[model samples]
Every structure is written in C-alpha cells, then in structure tokens.
Target: MIKNVEIRQALPADAPAIEALYPAAFPDEDLVPLVRDLQELAAISFVGLANNGLVAHAAFTPCSLAGRGDNVALLGPVAVAPDRQRQGIGSALLRAGLRHLQNAGTGWVFVLGDPGYYGCLGFKPDDDVRPPYRLPEEWRGAWQSLSLSEHKTPLRDQLTVPQAWRRQALWTPYGL
Candidate 1:
C-alpha cells in the first residue's frame, strides 16, 4: 500500500515514466500509445507521485458534443502500478483529477469502464450521449458519465473524441 501519494499535473518530463507505466500495469494490453499520444496532444493529465515514483496516472481528452453547449471530456486509460493496484492510489488520483477538471469548468466527464469501479467515482450510465462508434449491446453499460457541474443537465449528444483517440481498436468492445 502506498502512502504519501501526491497528486499533480503530469509534466512532459514524466512521459518516459508514464510510457513505462502502462505496459507494466496492463501487460496484455497496448495502452501505452493511447496515453502517450494523448499526452503529446496535451490531454488533461495527472499523476500520483509517491516516494518510489509516479505510481498512478489518468488522462482525459476533450470531446465535442453535438449541439450541446456543455464542455465535456472523455476519461480513459488510467493506470496504477501493478504493485499499487487496489491500494486506492488510482482512485484517489482520479478524484483529484476529476476535481481539477470540475474546477476548470468541465461540465461533464465520460468513461468507458467498469460500472462498479467508476460508479464509486460518481459515474452513471448515460444512454443519452453515445460514443463515437457503436458499442456492443453487452458493453452498453460500460459507457458511463459523471457530471462535474452543479446543474443536473443531461449531456445528450454524440461524443466525438479527439483525433488522438480515433483508433478503432480503442473503441472496440471485444478483444480487450
């Protein structure tokens, strides 16, 4: 279990470490490029700094909502060091990142993640906002959203992720 996890904005110098993190965190998945490209594209990102190093990371990319005035972002590709998994470092880091986004006037944040895990972070199934590509029916519940604003407005629209996230494999509901 990690203590003294300081949450901070991910710096460019942290790229190397962040690149190494995903492969270790998800050995069977090639999530490094997703986050690396996102960072290069200036995605809103954060890191959990600990005595050892950056033990956790989370990145959110801006998304355009069709006909919606609200500012929205898509959260993904969060990673926690293998040893730090389930120690709450990832969750705390995510909470800190979410707070930063909320304070920055982000109206809502969407994530394609496990309902149980993200639900703890205030995300709910938002059938109104559809993903860029249609997700499998079995994975529909995996698409969720969390409102950062006080106003309970339904973010009803189609989500268009930034070019950095246009990879079809990233949107696939299977083999991952």
Candidate 2:
C-alpha cells in the first residue's frame, strides 16, 4: 500500500532512482534519456518519496511564445511507479510541482495529458496557444494550458520548446 509519500525538489543524487522509474512505468518507451536531457537542460524536477525511496516524479521545462514575453513552462514526463499508480502520488507530485513553478512567478504552464486527469487540476484545451509543430486533428484536443492564479488571458502565438521536444513525435500523447 502507498504510505506517507513526501514531495520535494529532486536533487542530483536522485538521478538513478528517477531514471529507473521512467522505464519501469513506461516499458514500451525509452524515455530515460529524454528525462535525463531535461534534467541536464535545467528543467524543474520534483520527486515523491515513501519510506525514503522515490515513488513518483514530475518535470517542468522552459518554453516560450513567439512575440510574447511572459514566462511559460512545459510539463511532462510525470511518472509513478507501476505499483504506485492510482494512489494519488502522481497528483500530489503535480500539485506540489505546479505550486513551485507558480511561486517562482511563472505566468503559465502547458501540458499534453489526459483531459480527465489534468482537467481536474485546472488545465483546459486551448487552441489559441499554437504548438511549434502541427498535431494530428484527433490529438489536438490534448494540448492544454493552465494560467497561474486562474488568469484568463489567452496566448495566441507559436510556442517554442526545448530542443529535446522539437521532435514532431514528442507533441503526441505519451511521446516523451
């Protein structure tokens, strides 16, 4: 059973455990390197621990909108150990991580995740903020945003993300 999970910023020493969590949670994909690259690129990473062991992780990386000067971030690669799924660990990690970014003065955060899940966290599909690449119509709905402090100002410019996320395939669901 999931125990008292603590959420906190990830440290360099947590790399090995964080790396292992990715592949174990997503066996069909090789996302360890991507996550590592994000870490190397200075993404804000957070981990959830229970019994002093890493159980969940979430990463938020920098992104920009053409012609607009507000601070923005991309959220992805959130993972929970297979054994820890559906136990609220992921949600707790996300809430804590988002709070970190918001307090850091981030104006907005974008994510491509399940509407049912992220929607509950105040994320909503926003066609206004265009991604750098074209997404399949079927998956367009997955692009969502959450303005910090519940701001309603819509972003209507092309979004630019980190080099690792430049791959067109990365714009799809679970493409990390």
Candidate 3:
C-alpha cells in the first residue's frame, strides 16, 4: 500500500540524495549530472520524504515561449527511489511542485512524460505551444502542458528551454 509521503522544497543539503535517486530509479541512465546542472541553473527543486529519508525528487526550471518572456516552467527529471515506485511518491512530488509554481506566479508548466500519468495531473497535449526541439513522430503526444494560472488560456508559442535542456538529443521518446 502507498503511504503518505511528506513533500517539501528541497534544501541545499539534500543534493546528494537527489543525485542518487536518478541512478536508483533509472539504472541505465546516469542522470545525476543532469540533476545537478538543473539545480545549478536555479531550478525550483522539491523532495518527497517518508520514514525520515528522501523518497522522490522533482524540479521545475524556467523556459520561454519564443518572443514571450520566461513565464513558463519546465517540469521534468522527476524521479522516485526504486523502492518507492508505485507508492504515489512521484505524484506527491509533482503536485507539490505545481503548487509551488502556482504560488510563485508561474503561468504554465510543460512536461514530456507518460501521457496517461500526466493526464491524471491535468496536463494535456497542447498543439498551441510546441517544444524547443522537434520530438520523434511517435513521441509527439508526449509533450504535454498544464496551466497553473487563474486564466486557462490556450498557449501560443514555441518553447525555448534553458541552454542545458536545449540539446536536441534530450528530446526523445526513450525515457521520461
């Protein structure tokens, strides 16, 4: 059974656990460096804790829509410890991060994740706002977004992610 996990903003000291989670959750991909890079880029990070240890992590970094300013946030690289998978920890972290973005005046948040998973959290495939880089044909629908502002207007521009996230190789259907 999935027990309640306390989600909270990650502090500087939680960096090690955050980095470790990537490998624990995704054995093949060494995303520890990417997590640190996103953190260095000032991404808003959060951690899910249960039984007195970190169980999950999620980050929201700034992104822009072509001409428009940085009013958008990119939610990604969320990971849950292997042992904590399917325990609702990832969802808890995502919900907390979205709440944080909403309170911080962020208008929209985009994610390239499982359609069904993100759909349950109110994200939908947005034909209006496109990703910074072209994704594979099969992965097109994976690019989804959620409106966190009071006004739920349709997004209308191409995304411009941070330099670190601008890599075309990063836009793929391989791993969420």
Candidate 4:
C-alpha cells in the first residue's frame, strides 16, 4: 500500500498518468479520446498521487436536461492503478471530486456504476427519475443520482444526457 497519498485537481502534466490508468482499468475499451474529452470538459477532475506516481483519478463533466431545463454533471471512469486497487485511493479521489462539485453549486450528479460501492457515497436509484436511454434490467438499479441543491427538485423522468457522450456504448443505458 502507498503511504502519503495526496488528492488534488488533475493538472496538465497528470494527463499521461491519467491516460495510463484507463487502459488498465478498462482494457476492452478504447479510452484515448474519452480521456482527452474528459480532461477538456470536466467541471472537476481529481487525481491521487502516491510515492511512485498517480494511483487514482476521477472526473465530472457538465451535463443538462434537454430544452435547457436544469444543470447537472456526470461522474465517471473513476479508476485506480492496477497495483493500487482496494487501497482507498479510488474512494478518496471520488469523495474529493464530489465534494468539489457540490460546493460549486452543481444541482445534480449522475453515474452508472456499481451500486454496492457508489451507494455508500449517497448515490441511489430513484424510480421517479429515469435516463433518456434504455438500460438493461440489471442497470436500472445501478443508475444513480445525487442532489446538491438545498431544495431538491424531483429529477425529470426524461433525462437528457450530454450529446457528446451519446455515441459511447457504455453510456447508452444511462442515456449519456
């Protein structure tokens, strides 16, 4: 396990380290452009550095409902270096990025991920809110949302995931 791990906003120099983690985390996927796009559009992106190098990273990108109804963000591709898994670095990076988004007045955040892990961080599936795309049965309960506004409004049934993310197959279920 790495000691003295520090979490901070991702820097331009951290791109290579961040890119390197993606393939290890999702080997079957082509993550080149996704990494580039996240770096470009992220409202908040964070990295955890250990003694050797970066060990974990997370990103949140701007998103909104169609017709410009409400503003939100998408949390995704949270990754930890292969050798660094289960050391709490991923959790730390996620918490830091989520806290930053909440403090920035972002009203809502959505994610498609493992419910077991994300649920512990206040992510939940609300039947009242649904994504724009069709998700698998198993994914329905995995789609989650977090509200940062003081007086939270019920999420619209029709989610409008960002257009740029729509082409990606992984985001199809979440309607990104």
User: Candidate 4: deviation at residue 2, Å?
Assistant: 8.9
Better of 2 and 3 by lDDT: 2
Tens digit per residue, CA lDDT, model 1, 1-176: 24688889899999999999988987888987788789888999999888859888999888879745558999988989989889898888889889999999998899988888899998998899999888889889899999999997876779977787788788864332
- What count of clashes does model 4 give? 0
**lDDT per residue, candidate 4, 26-88, as tens digits?**
787766677787777644688898885888888887877664757788887788888889888
In candidate 1, what residue range of length 10 has the lowest lDDT sum? Answer: 167-176
- The per-residue C-alpha lDDT of model 3 at residue 31 equals 73
TM-score of each: 0.93, 0.93, 0.93, 0.87
Task: Write candidate 3's Cα lDDT for 1-176 as tens digits.
Answer: 24667888999999988887888887986778778899889899989988888989989998888856858999888888888788787887888889888988999999987898899999998778888888777887899999998888777879888777866656765564
The TM-score measured for candidate 2 stands at: 0.93
Judged by lDDT against the true structure, how good is candidate 1? 0.86
Give lDDT: candidate 3, residue 119: 96
Residue ranges of candidate 2 with Cα displaced over 4 Å = 1-3
With a 3 Å backbone cut-off (N, CA, C), the pairs that clash in candidate 4 are none
